[model samples]
Target: MFAGKRILLIIGGGIAAYKALDLIRRLTERGAAVTPVLTRAGAEFVTPLSVAALAGEKVFTELFDLTAEAEMGHIELSRSADLVVVAPATADLMAKMATGQADDLASTLLMATDKRVLIAPAMNVRMWQHPACRRNAATLAADGILQVGPNEGGMACGEYGPGRLAEPLEIVDAIAAALGNGPLRGRRIVVTSGPTHEPIDPVRYIANRSSGAQGAAIGAALAALGAEVIFVTGPAEVPPPAGVEVVAVDTAAEMRAAVHEALPADAAIFAAAVADWRMKTARAEKIKKTPDGLPDLALEENPDILAEVAAGPDRPGLVVGFAAETENVVENATAKRARKGCDWILANDVSPATGIMGGRDNAVTLITDEGAEAWERMGKDAVARRLAERVARALGPVGAA
Candidate 1:
């Protein structure tokens, strides 16, 4: 996907800078021509020679190099690439970028660049969690800068949290997504993900074991296919994907509302495991335990979002729903596809024995008007990619099949 692409890689000063070398190598090996730009602080960690060696190109390190500036001004340097990437995007560098400061070469290029930018932030847990950092990150995101991760793990400072740089391959995938020109280009899609929380009281709520991994993956896959995705997600274990609009919600009602608001889409994927029921009348305060033992709680059925959307007046051309079952997965899902009035249904066994409820991998069967197609057990990401490809094939030009 990255063949003939030009990537301007800006390495920031951080313990994670070492990972940028591997990123350069990965980008180059994938047929991308990488232009390495090393920050002064970045040089303290990895030598320019190392970055250049991996990229197989000369490393640009200065804003005012007479010879290089004479050949290509900063504007040209910034505009030369198809995309700009900031690996090991330190808090300081992010702050600079957020504030539009161009005190150095890397920031200058980032400021001047018109191409899409992707950042992989790496910082201490505290710094990453700080209000200022969060604000800047939000600002950057709002400005359309794509971000990969500061995944949770032990940091160099011996602290553990979401301050670790994303794995090199993960960043590579993100880059490919950003540069890809897939069949769904210019299409708009909506995807609902995660387990919605139905409040039973002020503090307590009802939820499922869904980790939201599959939904997040599906959103990412769709984005990789060049679709503009609106991801309506409940509380998810996995972070939302880059390069998509994320709408966070807590209850099934909210998810439904958000999905409707995001509609007029080309397709809709209802992957969220919304609670079947909610408290009829949730108490304002926590329900205290009494000598009378457990209290009788009235339950009410939550809105069937998939059915509603599938049968809505503004329904998309394609509507896909998921049927998670403990038994007779295919049979149940086949029935669900018909019952819900959806075009397709993805059925999966989420029994405890399958370990797929909150697991990394999925074994799913695609149910449609024609028949059921059982897919082999694969990672959530693979399932998402396959589903996305199927969506593309289904919604593409008349002769696409």
Candidate 2:
């Protein structure tokens, strides 16, 4: 997809800097020439020799190099590439770019570059969530500087949250999307991600252990496939994909509403683990802990978004629903597929013992009318790419597939 493309890579300082090397190799292997610019902090993590070797070009680190500048000025260097990519975009660099801070060569190039920029952030969860960092990221997104991820998982801090950089394959896919070679190219896809939050009171809510990783990954994969993605997500721990339209929701009711509104997609994937039940009558304030006993809670069945979409008048050609099961995984998934009237069911075990739910890796069984197709344990990227291919095939060509 990247044949003969020019990719200018800006390597940032973060623990995930090592992953950027793989990114460079992948891009270069696909006939893309990479020009690497390593930040000072980035230098601490990777050697210029390694980066240059993989990129097949000299690594640039200095703001002023008379010899190099004599041939191509900084402005020319920045504009020479078809696109600019910042991998392992540390919190410092993101903040700097967000505020237009040009203290160093990396930030300076970010400020000076006219080409579309893609940043894959890698940082501690706290730093990524800090109001300051959040503000900067939001500002950058609003400006249309492309972004890929800071996925949720274990971080270098030994703490876990959403500040991890995406894997090499994911970064490559985003590059493909940016270059307009996405699998679902020119096709519209709707995806639901995360677990819906059912509020019990102003201070309390009922939710699940859904980080929204799977659904979000699917969205990114679809985007890479060249599909116009509409991501309607509930409250998830992970950051939204960069290049698509995202609609945020909370309760299952809200998710259903959003799903209905974002209809007529070429394919709709209900990957969200929407809460099946909600409080029938939630108190306006926090329920007091009484001396006698705790207040009794009432329950109500929530609206079924998957079934609704499957049965809706504007239902897409292919409707895929997730059967996240703990017991009788495949059996329940097949039943759910039949009951929901959806074209596909992706079932996974979340028995707490399986380490699947809210985890980085998944073992899923694809249930279709034909039969069930089970896969061995694999990373989420593999799952997403394989699932995306099936979607493209099922849809018949994104616009027409």
Candidate 3:
């Protein structure tokens, strides 16, 4: 897919640096030209000769080299690539990038670069969770940098948590998504996921059994097709997918606000199971059991994000909604499609018997203006792929736009 792409790969220091070798091979196999840059600490783990041999390009390691600097090599090197990638992005490297510190060649190149940067962070769990590191990560994200993974597994330090470098193939896929050379390349999409919480007090709230597996799958599928996806999610059981901008929210009101902020997109997918009601006057303190009687709780309706977005002035070209009905799935979904003013509705039976909620597989009926089409039960990932294909067709070709 990356036939003519040029990637500037920065190998950062970590045991995960070894994976950069495989990442280079994978990118090259997909016809991407890889230019490797090794950091001072990165050299501690991998030799320049190995990186240079695999990439078939000269390894850039210094900022003050006479031969290269005479021609302003750093400036050229920074802007020439289609994408800049940092694999095994150590905490130190991330901290530098976050703070705009250009002390070394890698940091300087990153600061000088005009192209998009993708980082695959690999650090010890404690370091990754430190307050400073967390703040830096948020800063980098706000700066529009893309990220792949720091998957959870046994670490080199004999400790275990979310600090492993993403697998090479996963990085390649993220590169492709970041490159956005696929069918939905120019399209922008918004997706909402998970069940929203409605606070009743400081210690209690209302929620649902949505695991967010399907929504996460859908976001991944859309991104794989090259759409720029803004993922607004509640406290989902599953982590948001890589290669998409994630907006985390907890309550329905917050989810609604986040969705509005992400609007004016090519399409919007309402996959969130938002709460219908919230406490009209939530108690400041936890409600305690009284010997006299049970406490009365007043409820009020929450914002209907899907309907409002569908009817809004800045509505997307295509609006899709999800209906988790316990009975008469198709009939109710068809009604919901019209009621919500959405172009399509994916309806599924989520009764206790179906095991659809919080489950890996799903069976949905696609309700459109034309009619209802029942899809066979399949894995959530499969459902997402099929739905994404339909979305692409409905939006028409990028060239047509």
TM-score of each: 0.75, 0.84, 0.69
Distance from true location, Cα of 308 in model 3, Å = 8.9
Please, what are the lDDT tens digits per residue for candidate 1 over residues 85-192?
999999999999999999999999999999999999999999998989988988898899988776656788999766888779768867876776557876899999
The candidate that wins on TM-score is 2
C-alpha lDDT of candidate 3 relative to the true structure: 0.89
lDDT of 3 by residue, 226-324 (tens): 798999999998778766889999999999999999989999999999999998988999999999898999999999999999999989999999999
Candidate closer to the true structure by TM-score (higher is better), 2 or 3:
2
Supply the TM-score for candidate 1.
0.75
Residue pairs whose backbone atoms clash in candidate 3: none
User: Deviation in angstroms for 231 in model 3?
Assistant: 2.9
Which window of ten consecutive residues has the lowest lDDT sum in model 1?
392-401
Model 2 segments more than 4 A misplaced: 14-19, 67-72, 123-135, 151-165, 199-209, 278-300, 378-382, 399-401
TM-score sort, best first = 2, 1, 3
Measured by C-alpha RMSD in angstroms, how accurate is candidate 2? 3.5
- lDDT values of the candidates? 0.89, 0.86, 0.89
